[model samples]
Every structure is written in structure tokens, then in C-alpha cells.
Target: MNVDRRRRRIVVVGGGVAGVEIATSLGRRSKNDQSMPAVILVDRDSAHIWKPMLHTIAAGTRDISQQQTPYLAQARDAGFEYQPGEMCSLNRANRTIGLAPLHAPDGRLLVPAREIAYDTLVISVGSEANDFGTPGVQEYCFKIDSRLQADAFNREVRIRMLQSVAQEQDLSIAIVGGGATGVELAAELMQLTQIAEAYGAPALSSRIRITLIESGPRLLPAFPDDISQATEERLESIGIRVMTNSKVSAATTEGFELDDGPTVTASLKVWAAGVKAPAFLTNLDGLESTRGNQLVVLPSLQTTQDPNIFSLGDCSSLTLSQGERPLPPTAQVAHQQAQHLIRHLPAVISRGKRPPDFNYRDFGSLVSLAEYDAFGSLGKYGLFKGTTIRGRLAQLSHAMLYRSHQARLYGFWRGSLVWMVDRLNMRLRSAIRLD
Candidate 1:
């Protein structure tokens, strides 16, 4: 079972921001130099979508087709191999990972379970909402974590809107969690109602009610206090109910039951609270993990149990400073870590150099409260140190993050073309996807 010392094979699992970046970067190198390692990316889904934009899809504010990058096509363009299947097990001793059988949409088995050998493996399987085992949440609440789930929520919203118009009743949506996903979604839902009203359903706006529930005292706890306050005010101004310090005891078909407060009777319920790495990772070949199931990795982004296997994005937990506060599960962290590995991994694999520690720079965070406005504070560093941005500028900056990600994946020229096409499409089609 000995692999050729000269032949290096890198298999990246997850196809998230980190995985795609690493795969494409390595693939680009190996494409030009045949002697470089072979790069293969495996993902359960056929397409990659920016995790940040999932809420917009759920609210129908963004079109799925515009945002999704097909894995097969991206692999071809970026010079990598793409495998469409879920990773089921890790055989570190054999340097192989097991893949679950692939099936068609109609439930037909397409490919039998198999294993792929890798000299090095990068796992970026990302994370899911942590319900904290809250009773009835899994049955009664909706989560906007993936494209399919978001699309399903969009379909549900559209149906409810139609029903609301027919019955002349209010459409109440209760979102649990005050983080970016929940806050941004509340705003988008409000804006979507406006868009729906303008597009022939004039009564829709008045009938739509958005209630954002936060267990904490305020929204966006990660952001500065002022930013959180401003977000709540903005949402309140739009007639969206902002419930602070509200703890949900359980969810029901009718709505959510608050531990100490009155019942929230919502037609639709959404849970967007605490995040935990995928459950499967806890049993991932005895890798050291957090209580939340995130694979515990050193600052070098390599797992404690296996140096050959690296993990990033939400699936991995990394502590930066003395206090040992783990970095937030964010796209920013993932992007930085991916770049770090891309730069250092080659040296480690080819030159027998130790992988350098990854240092994360917080460029600050921006929260887009729908199309009307956005706000955020920039972390103090360089020329723009300690600067706070709001309004249109913040909104534009928020958008540029997604655009930058696209540029990375598709290269500058093609990504710019996409931006232009999307702008043109906005003029030609409905602001929201009707389908």
C-alpha cells in the first residue's frame, strides 16, 4: 500500500469556499506543471453557492441560477477533478476516504460506494444550525442552510403569499436567532413583500408580518453594540417585530412557545441560531473535536490526530489568541485559511517544510438589511483603521464580498462579465424569482 514518494494526490472534500479555493489554486499549479500533485475535489452537491446568500434565496430576493457555480464546470475551468458524492468514512491508515453511493434525483443508484486514495485531504464540510436540542424544532421549524432548503422555503413563502391574498389574512413569519442569517432574512422577507405588492398583489405588504426573535439582548452580537442597535431600529421602522431576550422553549405547529414570554403565533417558523459542525464529523476517524462536533485543528489548520488531513471553514475550530476564543464560523475566516494553505501546502508537500500558522485578519463585518440599507464596523488596521461604515457605502461593500468570491472562482474577466449580466438581468426580469 505504499504510494510513490514522488506522486502526490490531494483530495479536497466539501466544495465550500475553502475547498473550492484550495482545489482551484492547487489545480491551477498542477495544470501547468505535470509534476505537481493531482488535485481532486469531491462534493455532495453538483453546484457551489456562497453560504452567505442562502437567506436571500429563501426570501426570493436572489435567483439561484445566477449564484450557483456548477462543480463539474468549475473543475474543468479551474483545472481540477470533481467527484459528485458524499464522503462517508475516513481510512487514515490506508490514506483513503470512503464515498457513499451516488444516486440520481429519482433515487436510482448511479455509482457504487468507493474509496479514493489521497496523500493529503482537506475537509471543509461546513456547518449547520445548532438547535440545542430544543423540543419540536426539527419538526416545526425551517432552516435556510443549503440551496435546496432555501428554494423549498421560497416555494413555501410564495404559496403562503397566494393564500394570504385569497383569504385576506396576515402572513406571519417568526425567525429564531438574531445572527446575520436571521436578521438579514427578516429584512429580505419585508422587502420581498414590498416587491410582491408592487407586482400585482397590492395588499401583500400590509398583510406581511415578520417577527425576529433573539435569545440574546440584541441582534448581531458579534458586531459592535451600535451596529446591533441600529439594525434593530431599522427592522422596527419597517414594522418588523424585534423581540429581544426572548428564549424559545419549544416550537409547535401553531408557532414558538417562549420560556417566559407569550406564545409567538407564526404561520412560518425559521431557526437560524447557534452553529455546530455536521454530526458526522464527530465520528470522523477519531479526529479530535469540540463539544459542538467541530474538528479541532491547530493554528496550522491541521487536525490534532492526523497531520496529513486539514480542515477549515465551519467544520474546523481554530483558536487565534491567548484567551483561546475560537474563530467565528464565517466565510471570511474560511477564505483567509484557504489562501494560507494554498501558499504553504505546496512547500509542505513538495519541500518537506512545516506548514506555517494561519493568522486571521478581521476586516470587519457588514450586515445588509435588505436593499434599502446596510451597516457595519470595520476593524482597526492599516489606513482604514477604526472606521465605521453605514448606508449605501456599506451596502456596496457587502455586495463586493460576494463579487470578490466570484472573481476568485471564475477569474477576474469572466466574473466581471457575470456581474454585468446580472445587472442587465435585473432590468429585464422581476426583482424576485417568480418560479
Candidate 2:
């Protein structure tokens, strides 16, 4: 509780982008120092995968093996300890976290519930697909909130494609939510269908039907209207149906039941609607949170009630001056927050002074539709400020975003090597098939 002392131990919750970024930054920042905090990263998964690329995995465009980085390896390489345990509860008063017992596949307990004390804490447990309390959604719909969930959906798509080919019946696929995830997934599904047909599943293409259901007026509601319209046109050209202003009230065994009293039958159902922080965070002690269950944090990225506890990414909401609402849940925001905290956290750790406020820049948005096309706004360019671009340039720019994150995480040389490796792997491997 002393201000002028260094933290002996620090624990970072969540192994996603934000957590890894913060942990890696802390290691880099404290490299020259003799006395540094021992950093421990706690996550439920054994490996880390870029959440933005989940759509590609589900579409079979990118293999999970290629995209995934082992958390243990990264932690070891980055000078941190990795703990593969879920955070069950947080006792702020005691400065300890209660970890849930980890279980083996065979139902045996691997690790018992344990407590870990920390001098500083960072919670970056990312969000999950919110069903908006739709009836029967939890039971019937496939949610692409995690790698495991994405894999399951991909497998189901493969099975359905095979079934369609065997029976010569239409294989209907329905995607709920028209945000980036839903739009990108629709595009990926189209690509996967093409690949399946080219790879000895000719009958599959004719029977494959993709439908996007959005409760809003257009797809990519976060972007400009022109970009959204362009995406809609591209989807239509590829035989994917776009249903706007259609809300899914419930999910039945076969498909989604619409709020307008119509049932859309599909062989596979995907729920990408909205995002909400994990429910556990909402009821955690007296921590301040928004209506959507996101932890409310000051500009310094510290929780309102406790300066020892910091939060970032989708798990936390920081209001910005440019926008009336909180910053949108995007990888760019998380990456920026990580960079901001990395620069200022040392002062707070040593001097007990709140760091300078962080400002989030609006760098525009990009949406990729597989290999077909990409479109987005660049947010004030040259003389044409607030101009939007589309086609190849947009696609290239869209990909660079992921590369930028990799650059920060793996550094310049290693990140470039990994990027080259990904390209080589893509060329060497055969195109993935849906069947």
C-alpha cells in the first residue's frame, strides 16, 4: 500500500491481446532494472489466438495451428509466468484471486482452487457473444466467442456440406448479427463454399445457402453507410441473402425463429450479434461497471474503486472526448490502451500518482470479405478529410492492422519472420474444403 515502493508481484488476468500486450510491455519496460515485479499471466486457455481472426478459422481460411501461439512459450520468452487457470473470484480487500479448479478431459481434477497474491493487477478478460437474452439461443445457436466454439461451428459446417452433397438438398446457413464478425463470416462462408466445390465437392456449392440476419438497418453498422452498402452488394452478388431490420427472437432446434413470426431453417446457426463482458465481472464486489457489464475505468486505465486493479480491452470501458459513447470494442483500442499503460504505469507503481489520461484516436474502420474484397473509411486523408475507400487498397490496409499488432507483440524481426511464415504456409497448404 506504499506509494514509493516497487511492486514485488503483479498478476495479469486474461491471455488475449490486451493481457499479453501489457505483460510483454511490463517485461520490456523493466528489462534494465535490477528489481522488477514478477509477472504472472492467468488465463483459461493454454494458447493465445487473435480474436479478430476467429471468423477466418470458422470459414476454414486460416488453420488454428498456424495462427495460435502457445501462452506458456510466450510467457517464457517474454519473462513472465503462465498460469492456466480461470479466475473464479477476486478479493480486492485481501489482494488475492481465487482460481477455479482446472479439470482434465477425463473429469479428473488437475489443479485445486488456489489463491495468488498480487501487488498490482490487470484484468483484460475479453468479451463473449451476447445473445441479448433471446429465448432458446443458449441451447440452439452456435456462438463464435472462442477458439473451441469456432472449431465446433466449422466442424458442423463441414458435416452439413457433406450431408447436402449426399442428399442433394439445400444446406442453409444462418448468421445472426451484422457487425464485422457477422459480415466477415458471411464472406468467409462464401469462400469456403467455393473451396469445397473446387476440392471434389461440386454438388455442395449449388445446395449451399448463406443468409445474414441483422436487427439493424444495414451491415457493418459501425462503419459509414457507403461501406455497408458496398458489403451488402458484394454479398448479394455471391448468392448470400441479406436480411436487414430482422431480429431473431428465438433459436429453435432447426433454425432461428424471427421476431416477425417466421422461422428460418438452416443446417448451421451462428450468433455474432453483440458483445458483453463476462457475467462474473458484473457481480464482482463493488467494482464500477456499465450497463453492459464492462468495468468502468478512469482515463489512466485504473478501476474506479481501486488503483491497484487495472483493466483494458473489451472487459473495460473508457469514455473518450471525441465520442459521446465509450470507445468501441476493437483490437486497435485495446492495443492503444496497452501502449498507453505501458508508458505510464511505472510512475503509478512507484509514485502513487495517477497517470496522464489516455486519448483514443479514431483511425477509421475496415471490413474484409474473404478474398473477394474489402472496404472501409480511412478517417481524414490529405485534403479529402473524412473520406472512405474500398476495394484492393482497403483490403491491404485491413490486413496491415493485424500485422501491426503482431509487430508490437513479437517485435520487429520476429514479427516479420512470423508474417513471412504465415504467407509460406498459406501457399504450401491446400485450400481448405467445407466437406
Highest lDDT scorer: 1
Superposed on all Cα atoms, the candidates' RMSDs to the truth, in angstroms, are 2.3, 2.9
TM-score of each: 0.96, 0.95
Please provide, for model 2 over 281-315, each residue's C-alpha lDDT reduced to its tens digit, 9 standing for 90 to 100.
88677899987889999888889999899999999
Clash totals in order: 1, 0
List residue ranges in candidate 1 displaced over 4 A. 1-7, 104-106
The lDDT of each candidate is 0.90, 0.84
Error of 1 at 167 (Å): 3.0
Model 1, residue 238: distance off in Å is: 0.8
lDDT of 2: 0.84
- Write one digit per residue (lDDT tens) for candidate 1, span 313-363: 999999976535999899999999999999999888888777988888888
Which whole-number lDDT from 0 to 100 does residue 375 have in model 1? 91
